[model samples]
Target: MDMINGYLEALPEEERTPDPLYRERLDVCETCSRLQNGLCAVCGCFVLYRAGKTSSECPCGLW
Candidate 1:
């Protein structure tokens, strides 16, 4: 979790997703079957990390 937080903190403010959208993206991930141990099975990425970036997209195209 700390690693993911660090990655998020490293992103420029403009490149970070807005709080509301990030939360929304997380909410979507929460309901996805591809979510496993906080990671996205489709792309092998931490959902928290992936959702934090403004340019990131869900591998399953849910986001």
Candidate 2:
């Protein structure tokens, strides 16, 4: 979790997803069957880090 936080903190403001949208994306991810150990099984990305970026998208098209 610390690593994910560090990566998020390092992103430029414009590159980061807005707080509300980030949370919303996370909410979607949380309910996904593809979620495993805080990661997206399809893409093998840390959900925290992927959802925190404006450019990131769910591999399953849920968000």
Candidate 3:
């Protein structure tokens, strides 16, 4: 997806997850079919961005 067309709703700084946790989640998303580039087709959020959110969930339940 284009930068302007991607999910712009970012999690507040306080709600973002720690680097390690995000990295772990990203590992899973990377191998998932629902993941495209860094974006999640199910949630329309970048895998890095979405994985960084403590509250964000993987629609495919892989994360």
Candidate 4:
């Protein structure tokens, strides 16, 4: 899984946005990951692209 994680890690931070609707969209993706944004919204694992530490990171691949 390191390849997958690394691929995610190398993404640019600008790719992430703090839109409130993104959170709601995250919830929806939990059931089905159909979002074209290419983020793991259910687990918020995409936060790694933002290039900083967040509370959500510890439990996911962000570490």
Give, for candidate 1, the lowest lDDT window spanning 10 residues: 33-42
TM-scores, one per candidate: 0.93, 0.95, 0.69, 0.28
| Model 3 spans > 4 angstroms off | 1-13
Provide the overall lDDT of each model, using Cα atoms, as 2-decimal numbers: 0.93, 0.93, 0.72, 0.42
Q: Write the per-residue lDDT of candidate 3 for residues 1-63, one digit (tens) a residue.
A: 355223323545677877788778978987888777677888787776667678888887776
Looking at model 4, the pairs that clash are none
Q: Where in model 4 is the C-alpha error above 4 Å?
A: 1-3, 17-23, 32-63
- Model 3 lDDT at residue 29: 87
Summarize candidate 1's per-residue lDDT along 1-63 as a digit string, tens digits.
898889999999998999999999999999998889998888998999999999999977899
**Taking the tens digit of each residue's C-alpha lDDT, what string does model 2 give over 1-63?**
898999999999999999999999999998899899997999999999999999988888899
What is the lDDT for 55 in model 3? Answer: 88
Clashes of each: 0, 0, 0, 0
